[model samples]
Target: MREISLDRLRTLVVIADLGSFAEAARQLNLAPPTISLHVAELEARIGAPLLTRARSQVRPTAIGETLLLRARRLLADADLALDEVRRQVEGLTGRVRLGASTGAIAHLLPQALEHLRAVHPGIDVQVQVLTSQASLAGLREGTLDIGLVALPQVAGKGLEVTPWRRDPILAYVPADWQPPARVTPAWLAQRALILNDSSTQLSRVTNDWFAAAGLYPQARIELNYNDAIKSLVGAGYGATLLPQEGEAAELDRRIVRRPLRPGLWRQLGIACRQEQVERATGYVLQALARLRQ
Candidate 1:
């Protein structure tokens, strides 16, 4: 039932950063005893020792470290909330934390951010590469303001999902290698194949495609990065299934991309907290839409 004081939480963070109460007090413009009292009050409220005092340094206990982590996030959110209010009054100028998959980061975000930067120079966008599931978890935890993830994602409560684009999965082979007009699972099975690792949703979809055709290809190599897979394929290592995206001329010259017989595709979408669908987060979605157009 006791509410932790923001001032005391901030004091705890400063001490953790400086590793000395004296330094924390100097930085915070408070006396050493005042800093110590702030920490002590927090410890008394939490019923745990927060710091270990040594000859010259102070460190947080395990429980203190845990609390410090939460406290930092809480403090950051509070700061961002104030910043958001100021930005709303002074035009668009706030931070948007975005989580996305590797492909989305490599192929999509650059263009989206380019458009966003030109339009809203004040808004700061922070992007992290993460799997769809991890991005979803980050959205739920309030760590990320928006997510660009593969579609067919389970839209549980509190999320607003918008389908963005559908990228067809294509087979990348050596330029010199000749293949059917429309590649088939049977055709791919006859040769060694470079594949996405089993951890990815793309790999799972590819596996199902192979299963439906009653073919299990020899996986010469499994990697998580599209560029790596393309490099290997270009070096005559093996063919791979990858989303169709614009590539560099060097990669384009080395490999030939072909569509599959049945046409497999991966759908990508944007997700955000339902309540955040109309704020700075929505600005990002609008930028992405412009890129699509």
Candidate 2:
């Protein structure tokens, strides 16, 4: 069977409302013959007489009334679907996939999320906790829209890697241990240590820091997540070095954070495929920029 035409359906609805073919034509800005033909074709397709001449005012047959009810709903739904697509095309609403480390997700992403919610509530950001290398791979493979990655990156072709922020690496230790004003590789080396696994960029950075001072420290346990490492430090399991994310409102009373003597700083970059940047992604990029320090 041939599919029903929406234009013809619209004509049926208008003619029923006006009760006159001439008035429907005037309202639709169509010729009178075109309005009559529209209804004629609809009735032919449905194999039923849709309209009738009752005294003076034109009215719909029982079958016509059923189609009119369904037509109104279909037209309304079609219009709504088009409007949503328009909003997405205009960047007023969309979904963006983002990748970042667990540390950034915990300390940094919430502020960006809040900003996005206030400004572009219709934009949905899907986040994935990934290593810096994995984030870059995702960008290359077209799986991720944006990545918050540890720096010293060489932006590949079509990729934009921009330095976003710098944070100092600090020593987190049991608060009960009264240590020096500043932590050095030698001092930290002597204590029981918790370190990020060798697979992480932070692990490499920390290892380099220790190696520079002619001290190669061994970790009592290896873990990747920063929050978990902090918890271990609070429990006096060991001390670990991690980036100071921001001026935290509440300090963990059980664990004390102290700056490194050599002032080791961690650099992070905002990475994205230049060609793949959409309007919604740009909005999220702006939100992340607000955290630049």
Candidate 3:
């Protein structure tokens, strides 16, 4: 039997993902013919046609889909082996691609990253701000090493999730406006409300909180970034609800954060592929756990 090559397997995975040999070639920095040859070679070795090519697109055949699944695991294990060697020889020198929600990125990850950098100087971290759904998709697709996301997440097969923190969702109103010690959904519904964009889980949670009380406030504006939302709140455009980590001193002084009447909270946590948890990623997880403590 002929031996399979990791390079060819990686090429196959990329081609399957991109659905075009030309696009895969561009991504892998190889010629289109080279990609085609790799696929043809693999198909010959496996004794079956792996992909169905159309005029404009390509899709893996049934057998190809099975192979693609194993290919991902093989590639992941091979990378893990290399990362392990690098960690032992050079002291945790590797890259960790982290996905996080906007609120978590803005308030939570900075301190954890600072501690990681201070301790493991060689570990490089790249953060992508994404919604919980997008982050989970990235984890499944292997684009993200770990994700900090809002919880009640449905952990798919081969994914591990752990609680990180429970941040209280607070209402931000103009400093001059007199708010009750505990702001109620009804009370908030009477005022102009700024909220997170509909694309975010926070927005859904906020909407549910109001719906639970049978109140749906007309949102004055929907902004995605936390800073922008706070700026608008401080400018007195409207009151907005957001997750708060301790005191948000960064907000404009003209805005004041008031606790919600029912004390709504957003649960946050770390998620990673089960196979990816024993390397530099493990160290980062430890740091995050310590920070939470």
Candidate 4:
């Protein structure tokens, strides 16, 4: 099989960006004919015409368009790899891309990221805030360098999970109401509740909890945004079910928080694909470790 050459890929990128072979050649300091020959040789090796030439302009063929996308990514990765190698040798920098669940982001991630930046300023951290399901999906697809997710959900195949924290479930009650004598599913059902959006895995988990207990709350509203839910609960509209341990001052001041009886809780953890253990995943683990202590 013929190996694709960097020069060939560069020719494609140059032409695509500058919109003309002559312009690309001028910018690249190569003669126009040389650039044309490079592209033609690459196309012949690949057994496809890479460009559709018009009277005044040139465009990529379908296969060329696809190759163009991959070429850009390949070139970018090559550059990143070189930088990473140098940084690794010098112990100066690392890049980590992490997917975070909403609950984790609101509660634990800010402190973790701040500490990482303070201690390892050379390391670049990119965070993607998403639902638990989406976080898992991103990890599976290799787009996410690492992830923090609620446990049990992270125990799936192809990944490893490290327990990070256990957060309790808190009951948001009307401002005018006092703490219930005891927290129970039936007691929770007595209040008008504002629930998380139906699409969220958190919502599904909470709903399943209710179903298992043989009780259902009177849901007055169903929304996703935690801030919005807190706002509604603050206005004495209805109670909400928020994680017991995460940041909840907005909801706390307006409503009362009571830990559910029998200890209903969610476990938060770091998840990473096994293959990523030595790469960006290590950075995420190190960050979480420092934050915990």
Residues 29-105, model 3: lDDT tens digits = 99999999999999999999999988788999999999999999999999999987877456467788898867677
> Per the 3 Å backbone cut-off, how many clashing residue pairs does candidate 3 have?
0
RMSD of each: 12.0, 2.5, 15.4, 10.6
What TM-score number comes out for model 3?
0.68
Worst 10 residues of 2 by lDDT: 244-253
Colliding residue pairs in candidate 4:
none
Q: Model 1 off-target regions past 4 Å?
A: 1-85, 88-91, 246-250
Looking at model 4, residue 117 earns an lDDT score of 74
Best by lDDT: 2
Most accurate candidate by TM-score: 2
CA lDDT scores, all candidates in order: 0.85, 0.91, 0.86, 0.76
Per-residue lDDT value at 34 in model 3: 96
Question: Model 4, poorest ten-residue lDDT window?
Answer: 244-253
Q: What lDDT, from 0 to 1, does candidate 2 have? A: 0.91
Clashing pairs in 1: none
Pairing residues by index, what is the TM-score of model 2? 0.88
Could you give candidate 1's per-residue lDDT for residues 1-293 as a string of tens digits? 87998889999999999999889999999999999899889989989999998887899999999999999999999898988797865548778899987777888788889988898888888999888888888999989988887777896889877888888899898878897888999988888899988877888889989999998775989988888889899898899998875343446577888899999998888888888353566677788887552
Which model, 3 or 4, shows the larger lDDT? 3
lDDT-based ranking: 2, 3, 1, 4
Cα TM-score per model? 0.68, 0.88, 0.68, 0.65
**Which of the two candidates, 2 or 3, achieves a greater TM-score against the reference?**
2
Ranking by TM-score: 2, 3, 1, 4
